[model samples]
Target: MNPILQTTINKAKTIPISEERKAILQEFIQYIQQKVDAGKTVNLNFICTHNSRRSQFSQIWAQTAADLNGIEAACFSGGVEVTEFNERAVNSIKRAGFRVTKNGLENPKYFIFHSDDSEPIVAFSKIFDDSANAPTGFAAIMTCSHADENCPFIPGAEARIPVRYEDPKAFDGTPEESEKYDERSLQIASEMFYVFSKIKK
Candidate 1:
């Protein structure tokens, strides 16, 4: 692992998850545990309105956490509509210690790396059911309430898990922009670490 990412994981492991949140996370925990016990592949698709911030962070951190725990899982992120992955969110993720590489112009692709041995997660803004994603048998983790309520149905998801996060877009272009973005990224990272940490072989 990159030393910075190892540090972030160490810090995330120490962050406390509230009982209320844990109650909700337990549902996801049970689902993942059952899948792992069945020897089934676990796929999670994080969704938000724009795929710009929250969903991206959730997908990246969830995959990282799963990797840290030696859990075999694939993570993806998408939105209701296409938009470029916000640069601010990308910066925040980089600050949280992932190495990132960019490609393209209009809707550039981001390859986010957490560890040297794992393949980089390819991320960009697109609809939830984009051809890049698995058509079925994946969890649809709603990372923002709007996408959850509006989408009504996710074509092939086996589970629709609501794990909403406050949009850091609200803080964009402000003096606290960087701070808020980093805070949101760390918050998602902590929760993902909490979720994956519950898994037992």
Candidate 2:
């Protein structure tokens, strides 16, 4: 396993993490680990209204969870509108102990923190980068409702899954906002682990 992934797994140990979350993580780890063990490359595109909070969290944690489980898969994201990636989301990932780096020619330098030998989350434009964002066959995972309804056809998705998440942005500026965001992040992380855990070998 990669050192960064080990770091993430260690961090995954903190915060009195729940049994449900652990089960989900373990399941996800088991499933995706099988895929990687078979030498397959899984491509996931996590989407939302903006390429900001909820989708970002899903992308990060899903990829991290995959890595922690020893899966060799990549993650990407996009938005209905070109909203900037949330700084808070990035900060949360960093605080969770993953190393982040920037890479982009024009769009937001898709920040990536390597946890495995998988490709980083590349900054891909919704209007362009069809190859990277959509590819020939990929999963269009709707992490929010707006992206799902607005983008009825994702041009190249082999499958579309609604993994909706509560918008932490809703709690913005409130006293519980930070807690809410962290909670939201944890929830997505937990679920991604669960889904990947069931991936067919």
Candidate 3:
């Protein structure tokens, strides 16, 4: 891993997750463990109303946690509608210790790297069932309540799990924007670390 990201992961592991939150995360952890024991590939698709903020963070952090824990898992993110991945969210992730490279103008593709040894995660904003995503045998992790409540069904998803997070979009142009974005990113990273840490080898 990139030294900075390794440091970020170390810090994330130390964050205190409340009991209530842990209980909620336990369900997802159990799902992952069951799938692994059954020898099935574990794919997680984090979905939100827009592939901008919360879902993006979830996908990246989950993948990072999986890599760190030696879990065979693929992570992806999508939205109900197609829009460019918000730049603010991208910047927030950079603040969390990723080195990012960008391509394209409209709906730009972001190649995020945590380590030189691994392939970069290719990210862009798109609808949940975009061609880049797995067609089946993946869990649809709802990262925003709006997407979860609005999209009643996700075809090809083995599981539709709602793991909602508050949108930092509310602070978009405010003075608290950077602070809130970093806070949200850390919260997701911490939960992902906790979830993967519970997996039995």
Candidate 4:
């Protein structure tokens, strides 16, 4: 792992998670555990209204956490509609010690790297069922309330789990814009680390 990212993960493990939240996260843990015990690959697809913020953060952090814990899991993120991956979220990830390469202009593809040894996570905005993502046999993790409430059904998902988070997009253009974005990113990172920490590798 990248040294800075490893440090971030270490700090994330110390962030407090409420008992209520832990209970909800347990459901996610159980899903991964069952797959591992069955000798099956774990696939997670994070969903939100736009694949721009919360969902993107969840996908990156979850994949990094799984890798740190020696778990074999594939992580992806999508949304109900397509929009460019918000630049603010991309900046937040870079600040968290990732090496990011942006490709193209409109709806640019982001190659996010947490470690030199690993392939970069190619991130962009697209619908949940985009051809790039697993069509079936993956858990659809809802990362925002709007998508959770409105997206009643996610076809081909073996499990649909709601792990909602507040939208930092609300803070966009505010004086606390950067701060809020960083805060949300760390919160997601902490929770993701917590989830993988509970699984027995």
Candidate 4, superposed: residue stretches over 4 Å from native: none
For model 1, residues 2-41, the per-residue Cα lDDT tens digits are 7887888788778888998898788788888988999987
**What range of 10 consecutive residues in model 3 has the weakest lDDT sum?**
1-10
Backbone Cα, N, C clashes tallied per candidate: 0, 2, 0, 0
lDDT values of the candidates?
0.90, 0.66, 0.90, 0.92
**TM-score of predicted structure 4:** 0.98
Candidate 2 residue lDDT tens string, 1-201:
456446545544454646754653553345345546767677678888777888778877777666656666777777777756666676666656566776654456665655445566554335312445646455777888888888888867666777677798888789987778777876676577666656554
TM-score of each: 0.97, 0.73, 0.97, 0.98
Q: Give candidate 1 misplaced runs (Cα > 4 Å).
A: none
lDDT winner among the candidates? 4
Clashing pairs in model 1? none
Ranked by TM-score from best down, the candidates are: 4, 1, 3, 2
- Which model, 3 or 4, shows the larger TM-score? 4
Which regions of candidate 2 fall more than 4 Å away from where they truly are?
A: 1-40, 102-107, 114-119, 123-131
Cand. 2 Cα-lDDT: 0.66
**Greater-TM-score candidate between 2 and 3:** 3
Q: Is candidate 3 or candidate 4 better by lDDT?
A: 4
